[model samples]
Target: MKSILDTVARWLPGTPEIAMVLGSGLGAVVDEFTDLSVLPMSDIPGFPTISVSGHAGNILFGACSGKNVLAFQGRIHMYEGHSWTEASLPAHIAAECGARILLSTNAAGGINPLLDPGDLMLIRDLVVPFPLPRRWYVPDSPAPVARTGFTGFLIDQKLADDARDVAAESGLPLRQGTYAFVSGPTYETRAEIRFLRRSGADAVGMSTLPEILTARKCGLRTIAVSAITNVASTVPEILTHEDVKDQARLLLPRFSRLLREIISNL
Candidate 1:
């Protein structure tokens, strides 16, 4: 991990205070960068290749809204056969690079009644159904910290407020709620969605939890926003990854604006 961190440090032009983890089809936001260096995951030591569709698999260093930012153009998931630690390496690397604020984004199925496709939800809390696997032992590095409670300070409130304020000023209505993380290569069934809704989840997805847990342990303040890509199980239509990709692209402008404004406020 140290060697990987050191290698990434050398590639950085300057330390970034803000870091973003781009999810699913949200990678298009990287195209907005002015002075940028795109580092492919394949070039980074100890990083795994991203295999999922709609993920661009690169680390972008540049300025957005006049703030220095490190944007991860893709992310890994546990369902892809990576351990939680491996799935979260990007956030840890961002922390090592001196980024104090971590902004993560994901495309999720809307479980709440009010949410529709293309709507954005700010995660005030998370409900992870899968037992968060114990952090993997890394050579010469301290073991990762365990969260004492499920929702103990996962997303910082001040950061959430700042984001909301920015959205209000921009006339973008941002929904706030709990995000439930499921281990998935498969999307949820109707029964599962009903259970999650009963459990108080507003949106559901397969990513974000591992990375958010990793960011918290690394002492980086975190905030996550979910782009509602599809209605989960409520509608009779079959959902497809291609449908998720399409909706995410359609909502890029709102996502991109919120990201830039959030960084500016931070």
Candidate 2:
């Protein structure tokens, strides 16, 4: 099968400044865009199928606050048996389509005590369980550097600062913290939740890491946000994906507004 990069390249809709990934129930943000064009992910020749609920599984081209955007209304995941490259395909496509920034959003279980359902947490950094490939350092740099002792922030802080200004100006509450990425079709156990909180994760989710890493590798400045959909507690409280999606739905209008304004200024 031909790569969808070629397909997207041929029919690219706009010169988008940013590429946005809408995660889980977060996909509805594209509805706020003007001059929107929609393409189902299934229609992209080599694109993978989406099995998760609440993901609309489409690519959206539109303008948010007058800035042209290429937004993916859904995303692939490593938990879905996709490779790291496959999970991050949207990020790669966004760069190929001429986007300079990547803005990604997801629904996560709050790992921090102060965070609650319905809060929007800015991803200041990420914590993953294992090593990532060393080949990603921005585009057109020297050869991909070997993994050194570079224990710096992987997610861009400048972009995070931009979002902070936007949130403050909008009078919307925002939480800034670290996000933990895990491969899962299951929720975390109490021990797992404890481990993550200890490791500095304020929110936990199954997606976003691969996408963020890929976006950075392609020279796209990246910003990630999470809709804290539930609290991953030390107590074994039963939670469902449906519950997570419901909370994200409730957060949509407010989250959408904040995200739109941030995109305008970026």
Candidate 3:
């Protein structure tokens, strides 16, 4: 089996400054990349295979505004039945390949009544709310997700401020919030949503938390953004994966705008 570095080196010609993970319908963020070189996630020695619908499940090496970028088109979720080791590989691999920054995006259901569908949010913090701790993996170690604790710090404040500024300038506004990370292939129940809200969570999602933890652990500055695809209410609403994807897709122009500006600024 090839080492993670070897696998990345074989596909990427240059060290990427930014490593981005796209979620759900947000994979369209890569549509603007020029000089694209594709590497499927399945080709990676130990990365988790994507099992969800509406996720591209590939890694892309390309230039965005003359800056070398490594992008994961879709992410591996814990809900997909992946272990911590496999779930943490994307950030581990990106950092090992010399990426200085990790930018993660996800589609979340709004727990805060103020958030609306198609709203872009800059995640100020994350809540894993479970009794068990989140694990962090070392980038160069044999056991990628070998570590056992999470850092109190997750989002890079400076970068997040930059993102907010960029969004403001681009006319794609960003709402600031705490994201609730759940281990779920299922949408949150009404009671669970209430619990998250009481815990100060403004948005809720199934991915991004592990990757952000892994990124920060690897010494890469991290920034996380979420597109509010649905609003969670006490009254249950029938939400499907397609609804989440469609809402996210509708935010493309705005999401992509802030994304491009963020890259250029970085």
Candidate 4:
């Protein structure tokens, strides 16, 4: 895997200081970058393909707000039937490519009372349920279990403040929250949503944590934002993926602008 990333890095013209992962409908943010060169995941050796809708399934190299950056237009999720290690390849590759900072975005159901649909929430912490592999989980066990736990890095306060300022300047609402990652091809049931709220989760989603853990392990400073796509715990209706997609589309422009401002300021 390291060899493959090395080969890919050789194909890249320069080292990027920042790496961005586009989540859900947020892929449009890559359009704001200049001098972009896109490489499809299928074309990159050892890169996992994204099977879900709203992900662009490619990597874009360009300048975002004066920073040399590499942006992934999509990401693999645990719900896609991929192992945690497989889903985290992008972060590992990004680290190997010399990015010191990792930025990620995702659309999630808002569980925090103060959040609303279309609001952006900065991830200050993550609470993960599964363990990530560490070569092997137990002595004498032939198969290695993935390592998993709380990722210790917090988002840089200056960056979070800058993101908040950007949201305010753009008239987009911004909030802070604990992002919850669930293994899912399905939306959470109402009872599950209630349980998450009781567990103190502020937002809920199907992706982000594994990538965050992987990024921190590879020595990159990580920051993540969530676009609130639905009100999970309070909504009376059952949720569907289509609902997330529709709301994400409605929120893309503002979300894109907020990301642009944050990246520019960084």
lDDT of 1 by residue, 1-266 (tens): 67778888999988898899999999999788889998888898778778999998888899998988999888887777777667787788888999998899999999998999889999998886545444334443333333434446789999998889988998988999999988787889899899889999999998887778778878999999999999895767788889999999999998898888878899
Across 29-131, the per-residue lDDT of candidate 3 in tens digits comes to 8989998888887787866679888789888989897788999998888666666656767788888889999999999999899998888899998887754
TM per candidate: 0.92, 0.91, 0.90, 0.87
In candidate 4, position 167 carries an lDDT of 69
Candidate with better lDDT, 1 vs 3: 1
**TM-score pick, better of 3 and 4:** 3
How much is 223 displaced in model 4, in angstroms? 0.8
Q: Once model 4 is optimally superposed onto the true structure by TM-score, how far is the C-alpha of residue 13 displaced, in angstroms?
A: 2.2
Clashing pairs in 1: none
Q: Indicate the residue-level lDDT of 122 in model 2.
A: 94
Give the number of the best model, judged by lDDT.
1
Whole-model lDDT, model 2:
0.82
- Separately for all candidates shown, the number of backbone clashes (residues 3 or more apart, or on different chains) is 0, 0, 0, 8
**Given candidate 4, what's the lDDT at residue 233?**
72
Tens-digit lDDT track of model 4 for 191-257: 8777888877999887887677777777787888998999987777877777888999999887887
